[model samples]
Target: MIDRVPAQFRGVADGVVAVAAADPRFLAVIVNGSVANGQPDEWSDLDLVVVCADPYRSEVVAQGKDFAAAAGPLLVAFTGEHVGEPRLLIALYGPPVIHVDLKFMGLGDLGERVEDGLVLWQRHDSVQQQLDATSAAWPQPDAQWIEDRFWVWIHYVAAKIGRGELFEAVDGLGMIRSAALVPSIVARRTDRPTGVRRIEQLAPEMVPALARTVAMPDRADCLRALRAAVELYVEVRGDDVVQQTEAEKAVLGYLDGFPA
Candidate 1:
């Protein structure tokens, strides 16, 4: 299984596996993301799911930095609280620096996964059995959910632009790209709504339009980018999804007031 990892990452991967196997508290280590899927490239980070004994979950999480440091020269490490998963320790390692994500969890957490990771090492068949019992389901975007918030978000972006807060306006534009447009565009082909992940490969035809949504710091350019985002959203959001008509009308009118 270590051979499946890219050449650059194999050493670190093997080191981590061996470290986890030697520890009684750590139950298993599963590799997920691009590396597990056999599609790793230079930019891909090592994503490891470290399953520990239920009783040791808290202790293991607390000592996450120590555990990760055992695998390599950990440059800096921190829990992924910002991304909502405190169990995850994101670390950078090396003279030849590499990014690694170690998501510490118990065997109980295996069933609720988005993808089936390759189990690099495990104490028993319990991990495999738990994975086999349930199918992986990546989250899909809800059209209604996006629709409900889209207009309000558009208004917010417009407000930032109107107030001459170009940075805020640009950030708002990014939110639209990642939250609304990227998913809608990616969903057209993969049915999986990834937020700007390999979007060029998935939907190259839409890249130019998507590129237009990125704004410069200037006022007119920001408004232009926002308009591009709004247009792109309308184009991608399918007809079947109900539109928020009054809000859309109000927001569009407000946006039109801005001189691009």
Candidate 2:
């Protein structure tokens, strides 16, 4: 994965890592994601985690782009919409147009997020020991969590149908898919996938269902997709027949509003 990165990228990563490794504020420097796994490609994003020591943790996160600019020519930087990680700095680098993601994480917050990272540098044995003590496992989304959201999400789609917002209705399907459906599918397997980031690779079988879940603007097709999503979520996630029945009834009621 690391090998697949462009040569310029190598230099950039090296520079960034070197800068962070030397900083007293940062305790460790590690590379992970596709690059660390040795499967990087032209489109692969650079994921670098900078373990900030206690004193400078807040300062580092608040100064996201400021710190990232030290590594190279960062044209622009923004905070990523990362679901779990908050201190993420999504940066665009140039002359050559490279994308680098820098996360300023603290020791207490790292948790299971640093499992497979190849440590480029560490402050000392003490730092390594601290890293080792923290779990490398990501917590899985559980049943109650998905169940809580699934019912409301089904209603969201139904309300969209009532409003004749086919575009919004179709888009609402994705909310259910990512939040509930994908997690349900992943939980059925033995692997410890954090989320559906690699759903295509992790569960290719479900891709077609995603296509089927997208509905046409017409009422019949919208209802059909609603049914498909409900059935799939129920099938993969175990039947909450009560919720399913309620959703079915509500969708049917909405569909009846269309002229026969």
Candidate 3:
């Protein structure tokens, strides 16, 4: 069984909520993600949102990290205001790495936005209205970007292997991220959210096929997984976008060179 969070950590969350509620500019504070989903393991971290009267009007971004940091010495890793979005802050803490993704949303407009799962811990009328307006929008992955990145990343992996950099090759073998594009495309084909991870549960058959295709016994196996990853990419994207790409040609040539 996963260890329940220490009372001190719970108090930290409560304290954060209290701080937000006391501020006139802050209308509501929502606890979301893993904790909200109730699937928290011992290493789980808090994901929260601080809904403000005006998203861009206040300095919520600057203060959020400071606030979380002040809560504990474990809050050492900070990803400052992701992707130029002032309304969000991402941080990590604890030895095992717990992530906290904090977002600031406009009070009146909060309900208009949609997130998959949100649990409101503290809310005013204005905040509740905003939360009510929230809609659920599935995130879309950039297929073209994934396609291009797959080839580039694999070639780098191949080069590392060629240079006898086994550790680097293993470290770089993040086929999961590459394999994710396939499921995203499949999900879109089935009319669901794209870019959703842990999709093996959705389609168990694909998981084994993916594993088989990407399995490698040694350096050769690494290359095999890479080739399979490329072929899988082609299968997902179709020939039109990826057919003429070098990755496609390389996989084909590799198959040709395979000994009988």
Candidate closest to the true structure, highest TM-score: 1
lDDT of 1 by residue, 98-145 (tens): 999999998788777878888888988888888889888889887778
lDDT of 3 at 77: 45
Please give the CA lDDT of all the candidate structures. 0.88, 0.75, 0.59
Tell how far residue 205 is off in model 3, in angstroms: 2.7
lDDT winner among the candidates?
Answer: 1
lDDT per residue (tens digit) for residues 1-260 in model 3: 01233343465566566667667777666776566566766666676777776754357666766766654445554544455666576766654455666676766545455454444554557655545567655455556556666666666766776776766666566554444445545644544443334457655666755674544436777667656665665566633344336775684665556542
Per TM-score, what order, best first? Answer: 1, 2, 3
Ranking by lDDT: 1, 2, 3
Give TM-scores for every candidate, taking all chains together and pairing residue i with residue i.
0.96, 0.83, 0.66
In model 1, the Cα lDDT at residue 7 comes to: 81
TM-score of 3: 0.66
